[model samples]
Target chain A: MPAALQATLEFLRAYAGPLIASLVIVAVLPLIAGYVVLVERKVMADMQARLGPMRVGPHGLLQPIADAVKLLLKEDIIPEKADFWIFWLAPLVSVTAAMLSMAALAFGPAFQIARDINVGILFVVGISSLGIFGIVLGGWASNSHYSLIGALRSAAQLVSYETAAGMALVSGLLLGGSLQIRTIVEEQARQGVWFIFLAPVAFFIYMVASIAETNRAPFDLPEAESELVAGYMTEYSGFRWSLYFLAEYANMIVVASVATTLFLGGWMRPFASVRWMGWVDFLPPLLALGVAGYCVYRAPRQPVPVQKLVMLGVAGLCALVALLLAVPLLLPAAFFLKAGIHGAFWFVAKVGAYIFVFMWLRFTLPRYRFDQLMRLGWYFLIPVSIVNVMALGVGLVLHWQYRVNLWLALGGTTLLTLLIALWLVWADRKREAEALQARGGPGTPAADSYAG
Target chain B: MLDKVIFYVFGGIAVVSAALVVTRRNAVHSAVFLITALLATAGIFLQLRAEFLFVVQIILYVGGIMVLFVFVIMLVNLDVALQQIQFSRQKWVALLVTLALAGQVGAMLWWAGQPGKKTLPLPVSVAAPAEKLPANAEAVAHSLFGPYLLPFEIASLLLLVAMIGAVVMAKKKV
Candidate 1:
């Protein structure tokens, strides 16, 4: 090869691993997000006392694939007045921004695709926020009143919640003493406690703001079907719409991954530092085994041979995964394999738990009015997070200056925040009661429910 | 070679989009172009190995400020604005401001490309070798929380004042 060509090839060789890893992540994430959608539907169905999508495959296992095909085959439309180029570009922007945010995420110690950027957390935050551009632009280009209003609401809501979420992240960053996701996880491992135990309020704020950021229910004013008629997505259809859907779920996974990495200890088994709890390392395979067992249990109960065959195949797949997980445990000498297996397993489990919580919240909470959502973000979450950040800062100062124990310092701050939270709740309730009395009726519009 | 290519590509995008921002007939299109320009600038910042500035530029400018600009554009009576003369009322004032800005930008660029000054290569510094430079978030935090703390506080107070002023101006009862 020519000298410059040789250098270029060498550069490609060096970066090919990360390049391939990122490509895999981009490919796999949408599929994962698809399954997440199915899981969300199933969980929501279970909550609402209904069977959801059972006919697609054995217990709706193939539902996501079916949905994918339908979306892919549907006609892509652009309204006559719509800005055609921007209309086409919007969903691409949304999905690209969301996927790009994942570049900074350390999936686990072993599974991370990108080199750990120093400004990892901020990179994720910045790129993820760029997705709002797609929403605003899509709505604008659609040339519809509902789309415009939805995008405007989304823009406002995203900006407002971001402040709280950023503050919440700062608190965890303070505890970790680093911006790198891996460093944050390692900090939790060293301390023998998840940051969630120390910064519960920060975690709470993050969870709420993340939901709002993702435009999930209770804060989903942008897409309030009853109000905004699918909101910014009003004009979208077919593959274009699926791209937005993929972006939403991918963003969900990103936020959940962040929460896991920052607050819950990225890939550490609970009680990781303790000697007796070493067995927790085996939990991944055990869980896989349990899943396989459940598949086996359900297999014979299927009405048809095809369903039974599918169930059996699922059970076999789960068993294979369990075997793979266990193989690492047996290879005591292979540190890389062990770490990769356990790290990915624990990391994914934590993400799954967070996603489940997201689904639970979505089904349980009623949608908030736009004003109420704004009030919660600004008055409640923002102020609370600010206080949390300040108190944590003070605690860190005390610990550094006076040689106070880290746990003691964090505990004191947590307790102080709890007291402040109590006062805030009380004050908010009092204001609501007064407003309710002024309105003068139980069934009146905008009446405060808790007051009565 | 790759470094030169990237610099030119993004720089080209920044210039073209900035021009579009000013020249677009529709206000919304102008805002969108402005965003494109801002993002291109942010990409340039990243290439410069100013990761802190890159993220801050994206988050604060492209994400926050541009959204506000878009919001205002959407809210305004764009139809009426479009119907009005493109170079109405403040043509001379606008020209004067643009000239001034162009002059300033020219001076900055001229200074930047001076022979004695080293132009940092854009592409090969994914891992920037400016170890001596205070370049990361820690450096930023230290500066904000330490020596420059007073100025930071003052800046925040200024923002608070602006916010309160806006609220007061908006409230008819007030």
Candidate 2:
């Protein structure tokens, strides 16, 4: 190799942990995040009693690969009026913005890729906003009407939802007391609880905002197939289109990782053994026996083999929430159990469930009308998330019994929100009647229950 | 040596394109020249071991802002004006202003070099080699949070105001 090449290789090898980890995360993250898309398709398909991608791989596991290949092999066509350079540059920006958001994700305790950052959440939110610029610019640069409209819709949708998303995230940071993913996870584990239980309102708001942020389900009006031809992607075809898809799914996984790290006890199993606590003994001490047997006198590769490959691949995960036994916290057994609880399975399960919800929404719900989508984002989500943030803020300042108080506060907010909603509905109906009388035409249909 | 080669190529592109930025007759052509200059500047940043700035420069300036500029130029239908004879009555004044700006730059450079010791490093020394630059977003964040916190907040607020201003300016009614 040339000296320059040699130096680059040396630097890579020297920082193998993070360098290799990042590569693996970027590479394999898409593979599994595709499973997220597949799960969405399958769940919706199965919900509708139709199979999704059955012919691709065994049980359609290879569907993402097949879809990717199809997109790649397809011919790339550019409009004559298109600015070729910006057309090329747009998707690259979107994908990089999407992928870089994952840099701060903490998978499990002691397993983070880079642990020193104090403002990981802030970093993610800032990066996530950058992705919208691509869609907006791509539409404008295409010099097409359809793309422009789609891009404008996306710009509006993203800006509106971002406020809600920020408020939702801020609530969690207030409750969790640290912006660092592992630190939050650790505090959750030690407190013997998850943030979802305490911050249920925030959790609900987060889910709604995140779905909107990822442009999933009913919020996917920007790319409504029947309407804007593929939204901002209307003009893009082949590999350029594939880059947009990559960014979309990568973004889906970023949200999943964020939700997992924040709301779930990030890799902490629900039922950790009490004897492991040395306080109670309902379950027998099978953990030690299993570890030993799995390690020696049996197929050493069987159990950990599965976890190790994933662990090695995603080396820098957020450390799992640790259960600190009074003694020998540093001992290997304690560490192993802690890691096992907060490891890939927990992350996969949590992230997977949220992703399932994503697919479920896609299959079940019809896309929103464009104006309805905008109004819903601006009026409903923005208010609810702000109220949620304010409730958490009040709870924190007042030193309320947070776990119980948050639920009560959520209940109260729901009731108050319902009452306000009813008042708005009545007022809207009165205005519509007056308008109809004024125009000598029948008033528009009454607003739906969910309508702003 | 590779860094020097890349820098020279990018710098040359920057200079030529910058000239084009000023002198291109068509507005759309001038916009395209500006985009090229921005990209070449990003390439120079990459050559100077500032990969994060390089990435942001390309992503933001070239990709985001310049694309918007190109779109605006296209939307205005500058291509149709190509056949029209266009002339500025103040051409002599514009030339004089250009010469005056050049003279001002020359004077500043001469004044800065009056100590007889070079401040800026020579081209070869400025860039030792080309490789991926270390990017520590956290360190940047830390610096912003600790020392530059006020400016950072001010910048964010200014950006928010700019966005609002754009919306207001574009709106048919307030």
Best by DockQ: 1
lDDT (tens digit, per residue) of candidate 2 on B61-83: 76456655655554665567776
Cα lDDT of model 1 by residue, A1-452, tens digit: 48668667776876798888899998898899999999999999999999898987799998999999999999988999998878888888899999999998887787676564677888898899999989988998999999999999999999899999999999999999988777888899998999998899999999999999999987888999998889999989999999999999999999999999999999888888999988887878888899999999999998878999999999999999999889878876665687777888888989999999999988999999888888788778888999999999999999999999988998998899889888887888788888877877574756666765
Over the stretch A1-452, how does candidate 2's per-residue lDDT look in tens digits? Answer: 58768666766676678766679777886676566667777777789889866655434656888877788799999889987767877898788878777777777664566555555666566566567767766886788888988887776677677677777778778778776777788877776778887677677778887888777778887787888888899999999988888889888878877888888777766644333653322112333333334434333332446444443322222111111221123465555554534355567667878877787777778888877776666666677677667766765654564455555665565455556546655765676589777765544445334457
Chain A accuracy of model 2 expressed as TM-score: 0.77
True contacts kept of each: 0.70, 0.00
Tell me the docking grade of candidate 1: medium
What is residue A189's positional error in candidate 2, in angstroms? 2.7
**Model 2 fnat value:** 0.00
TM-score of chain A of 1: 0.94
Per-residue lDDT tens digits for candidate 1, residues B1-174, read 445555677889999999988788988778878888888888887776678888999999988888888887888898899997765688899899989999997877777678876553224445445556664787888889999999999999999999999999999688
TM-score result, candidate 2: 0.66
